[model samples]
Target chain A: MDEFIRIEHLNQRFDLSEPWLARMIYRRPKKFLDAVDDVSFGIERGKTYALVGESGSGKSTIARMAVGLLTPTGGRVLIDGQDLHDGSLSVAEQRRIRQRLQMVFQSPYASLNPRWRVGSILAEPLRVFRLVDGPQAEQARVHELLEQVGLSASDARRFPHEFSGGQRQRISIARALASKPDFIVCDEPTSALDVSVQAQVLNLLKQLQRDLGLTYLFITHDLAVVRVMAHRIGVLKSGKLVEEQATEKLIESPQSDYTRMLIRSAPRIHRAAS
Target chain B: MNGEKSAWQRFLASDFFYDFKRSPVTIVSFVIVVTLILMAILADLVAPTNPFDPGSLNLMNGFTPPMEPNAFTGETFLLGTDDQGRDLLSAIIYGLRVSLFVGLTAVILAMFIGVSLGLLAGYRGGWVDAVIMRIADIQVTFPSILIAVLIFGVARGLLPPDLRDELAITVLIVAIGLSEWVPFARTVRGTTMVEKEKEYVQAARLIGLGSSQIMVRHILPNVLSPVLVIATITLALAIIAEATLSFLGVGAPPTEPSLGTLIRIGQDFLFSGEWWILLFPAVTLLALALSVNLLGDWLRDTLNPRLK
Candidate 1:
């Protein structure tokens, strides 16, 4: 199947217990929230696999684990046959692996640092990975990245606040591409934008994927977005993956009640009688 | 060149500069503080006489009132002479120099220590955070002046008696710096805690950057605005702390008296009708402290987005 990304029974349990003193006084046991259950999925090379779930369904948790930002409490995340959470890997190996993947967060405003110019923001991955040698090369690469995201090269001199929400998402996508990563985890990248802007950003992502032959684990709560973006879809409910199938088949006939309900609840545009 | 010019023009047209121009009290305080600082920095060139020089003192000129000829020397003193016959104007100028030096060095020292510790505590946030914050909590319970006094006393006790006077100013700086770092640490820690959770920091982490790299490169810049505001406010506190210590007879030595020392010397003759000694130095101290504090207040309100 040439799976480019694999999640093997991933689980994440967050400690929600009170402090030790409070627990002792109240005679309470330690409490925990299983944010991500033993869920598993895989995406083939150059394909998009979308995880659709409402808030608190642990979609973001799975996304973070996939990008190695958060280590799962149980099981493993393998990228290109390498265990991302494996402690035995050397520091250089870990970094080499990290350079192959990147993330696009939900909130465009919160994702890019406000204090930094767009040039520095895009150049960070390039600099970190030592992709370019000197300042001139770095600047050239930054300009190239800015242009690749449909922004002017001069826009690199501006700050993130100067851009619209969709443009900021483009910058975020540009940053993700800076490392020349083959795999990207996009966690609700367009959910915060307006409908028109969302379509633009989604089209940009699809265009980037087509051009770069990239693999993506696209996370979102929007079935409409998934229909346009994903080849395969996984419906997540309360930290568990309830259904997984080809996107068209699932949209046509969602097996799980939760998936059916989610599809039904999604807002639709009504047409006036001609 | 064009970019630099536009950036300057942008800054001049920013809401910050507009706010600064709008407030009369802030403008007045800003002017006062700048003038005082300039006077202190240029004291050597600005003062009428070398007040600290023993050879420059004339005992016959003692108790000379403002703009009045001395009874014996027949030489008019501008702000008058002290009990030691030193020029009050010159003494205040030199005292301003010492006061400003001590205040500035102490605040820099405190900010460095506090920001570093705060960054560590907030970023690491486990046993490291607990220990650093607990120490900050304990230090904050006591008035900072008392803590400074205690640190000064302990430091003085540890030094050799012969070097006590020689190292007194340095020791005083360290004392005030140690005592004043609690506010900076608490403030930086609070800001760092909030900043480290931001998605940029998470992105930095995901990009194979180490924890320290994320804290320093990514998180530090974001957390610096509050730190700057705290530093400005802490500078005022540090200056006042230095003055209080000097006033208590343990700060700047007699050889090089600060404003607080001048006030201490001035207060002795206050009841004996020589009130100018006490009043002049006290007024200078009040002006310096009040202006700096007002500027700090203005800065806190301006830089804080929540206030806006």
Candidate 2:
């Protein structure tokens, strides 16, 4: 189906052992939690594919596995049709795959380095990839990136502590865009920000997707944000993809009961009394 | 026009600088430490007579007392001369230089070894953590000075006896540094364990950052505040420990006498009525250690969020 990223039959089981007292009380050997039990999905190139779910629906776990931050118990993740678990793929190839699928974290305040200035924060990836020459050239490139992200070049020298919550989130977006990747997994990047700032960031992400031809795997519990930014949405529940449909189609006619409940519970402005 | 007031305001608004200025004891202690540090640094430019120079000594000026003219020579000894005809004022400066150097180098060595091990233990857990923590615990059961002596002995045993006296100061430093590292390791390990759970470290890992980058760039900076405070306190302890070791007659060579060695030499004439020999160096050593401990205590209060 012309997919850029695909996860097939993923299962993540964590061992939850009981303490000696609990074990004696329950008369059990061990317990196991199916954190993500057999979830599967795919994303098309140059589109915003979102996972909307309640807390602990394995939405974050799925995102974490997608970015190679966590290992799945049983599954295969294929990025650009290359199986990440295929024993033949070298470490360098896996790194290259990681370079493509970078994840913007959930908490904007917790994402950026507090000690680093705005400029060095952007230039870190460039220096890692050996993209720039010296400090002066790095500064110029960083300033340009900041300007593109709706920040002034003068703000480059300032520390992250100097910026507001919204401004810091924008700088994070700038850092994500620095590596020039094909795919980015934004894990609730605006959840910590104010609502008005959230809309602005969502619009910025949409504009960037259109201009840069980027693929986004957005994970969120907020359906309002999902409806605004997502072209297609996957309503995940209990570690499984319960409903998958286009954004407009899902809004028009949700076939699944869970999807309908989620849509109803989703915060809205108009026709709510109806 | 003023958005968040600025980080400087936030820093100033916090107790960091305000608490520093508020304490009179800290201010006085800070001044004393700064003056001593400057004196140690400019030992050559500030010292009146080069005590190291053989021609600078006058046997006729020997055994002079404070504020009293020498019976042998008419000129008075400000802090009084030793039995070897050395100026007490000039000797103390040289002694401070040696003590400061040894303390600083030992601390650096200990930090390097301890921090590296702590990172490995905390990051690469399982058996590695158990083994490192057990070793740290075992080391803690004994007094650090005894551990220093044991390590110092082992190190000296490895060298030929002829070089022992020659490398006396070097061996003492290495021994003290190795002994002092257990606290640093334990402190860093606890800090690294907490920091590893933070979201920024996970973000760094997700961005294809290497494990080393995650440790140094992300984890190390967060872990360093506690370590810095510990290091500051440890510097004072290390200096005092060196003095104790030297006073026990195993530290710096007699020719290049540290404060402890001067005290050791001065102890010989304390009963013979030349009390200035021991009194001056003892008082100077007391001042140095007290000032450092005061500053360290002030830093501990300032840097700690709970205390703040």
Q: Best candidate per TM-score, number?
A: 1
Q: Give all candidate RMSDs, comma-separated.
A: 2.1, 3.5
What's the number of clashes in each of the models? 0, 0
State how far residue B278 of model 2 sits from its true place (Å): 2.0
Candidate 1, which segments miss by more than 4 Å at Cα?
Answer: A269-274, B1-8
Query: Model 1, DockQ value?
Result: 0.80
TM-score of chain A of each: 0.97, 0.92
User: Model 1 reaches what TM-score against the true structure?
Assistant: 0.97
Q: Clash pairs of candidate 2?
A: none
Could you give candidate 1's per-residue lDDT for residues B1-308 as a string of tens digits? 24656777988988999999999998998898899899999999999999989998999889999999999999998999998899999999999989999999999999999999999999999889999999999998999989888988898889999999999989989998998898888888888998888888888887888888887888888888887887777877887888888899979998999999999999899999999999998898888888888888888899888888
Docking class of 2: medium
Per-model TM-score versus the true fold: 0.97, 0.91
Candidate 1, residues A152-253: lDDT per residue as tens digits?
999998999999899999999999999999999999999899999999899989999999999999999887888889999999989999999999888887
Separate DockQ for every predicted complex: 0.80, 0.56
Candidate 2, residue A181: lDDT: 80
